[model samples]
Target: MSHDDGYGNDSGRTGDGYSTLGGTRQTRTRLPDGEGGDGYGPRRPPRSSRSLVTVVGVIVLLLAAIAFANLGGGDGDKGGTSGGSGGSKAGAAPTAATGTKPVTGKNGEIAAGFSQDQQGAQSAAANYSVALGSAEMFDKTKRDEILGNVIAPSAVGGFRKTLDQAYSATLFKNLGLNEDGTTPTGFTFISRTTPIGTKVTKSSDEQATVEVWCTGLIGLAGEGSTKPVTDGWFTITMELQWINGDWKAVTHSQKDGPAPVGSDTRASSADEIAGAVNGFGGFTYAR
Candidate 1:
């Protein structure tokens, strides 16, 4: 079963959490001034027109203040401030990259030419995670291409054999895919992984161990489909080596996640989910 490893069948446990790209917003509501009387007590006198005008003016000023704050007043720019010495706070650690540019090279649609640093290894691991967990990985030709491009030369043969066994015919059947990993005529298969963050546990000049925290959606989306699309959270640890001026995965493994509590938002319909997955393109990740 898929479990929380972001692979296998959907019969196992899956997360119900939804992804929202932005931060939480707060909405303030104003209530009636008096306690409820259930039409049993004398009706309270309405506020004077002048008092109502004052409340409206205050609200307008509050809104203007909020707008000004959003325009780089309180915490800084919407893209966030740089972590450079003059701009950042002392002893404050940054969880994301401040000013690093994304990689511009590709190896048959996979990212390539990562720098020989911790950030480069992290970016490579994150992008590799997306490739490995994508629907393309189910197709043999694309799978082989991805394995060749991302896996270290020394590990390609063994990793290819192991993944072939893992993505077996039985697993394809369980996922509502054909033996060749194609979906039924009316169904769409969805498998996408988005990295939440990455941390380098160990690093040196030529090798590093990085863990990518990710959330994924995988299933068959179609009417009457038993395995409707569902999401899961998992962590992938990659042993990366700096080879030929790029970071490549020597070996990688996955386990269940340190997932957050599920949200109360209702799941979208299968058709809606399918349409969304087809319409949205995945991102190129960098640290």
Candidate 2:
């Protein structure tokens, strides 16, 4: 797969073959060539007007039903009731929260002091994923601080070197940032990862493997920005160890997603997106 870093003049191609602004590659649709007459030859006979109207009405009803079904769990009171068995309750509590309070301690700006249980592992994985994918990772000092806080002590040295190589000057330039990863005078650089949910694939008293399904927004948002902001889904697998009384990532890797289909919501303008990114504060995710 071509790694487009998600910014730049070459139609969103960074020198590293990845776009700093991530996006789902849109597939083009091709229309069939019609038989004769400039590809517009014989048109099909029109359906009955009444039949067409009925079909349209059914489609509208189906869409409404889908919309309502999606809203079912939004109400706090309706979220986790015991619906009858036989799969009726399945959607009622899909991954109910463990009810543990989020970590309030901070190691510099990163969340710290996660519990050593499965819930703690999931929480640590989710929070670490966000910190690792944030725009601060582009700055060397902040990146070092983040890695030092989140990565296991033994792994930090090697991982820091590897990440330094990954976030190269070329990649920064492609992202429309300076060599030091600072945004230009009139631009806002955004890179954020929000974990949808986390699962412990394997766990033990001392170690855990957690998967964080996440959606990320990345790009340069400004007037005349070549790479418009976009979002993409991905999963991060973290191998965590209970070291020094907390869950720390020993190793982690990312893979392109179990992404949902794109929504039909209209895209926001660059200024609107820039404003939102700057205005909104991220969550301290707990599971």
Write out the backbone clash pairs for model 1: none
TM-score of each: 0.68, 0.69
Q: Count the backbone clashes (under 3 Å) in each candidate.
A: 0, 11
What C-alpha lDDT do the candidate models reach, one value each? 0.52, 0.52
Residue lDDT tens for model 2, 1-287:
00122111111112211112122111111111110011111221232222222221221121111110000101111232212221111121234587778888888877888876667777888888777667786677987888789866766665554445445554566556788768888888777778888776655556666667887776677878754455666665666767888887665544456878666565677788888999999988776
Q: For all the candidates, what are their Cα RMSDs to the real structure?
A: 20.2, 16.9
What TM-score does model 2 achieve against the real structure?
0.69
Model 1 RMSD vs true structure: 20.2
The alpha-carbon deviation from the true structure for residue 156 of candidate 1, after best TM-score superposition, in angstroms, is 0.2
Superposed by TM-score, candidate 2 places the C-alpha of residue 243 at a distance from the truth, in angstroms, of 0.8
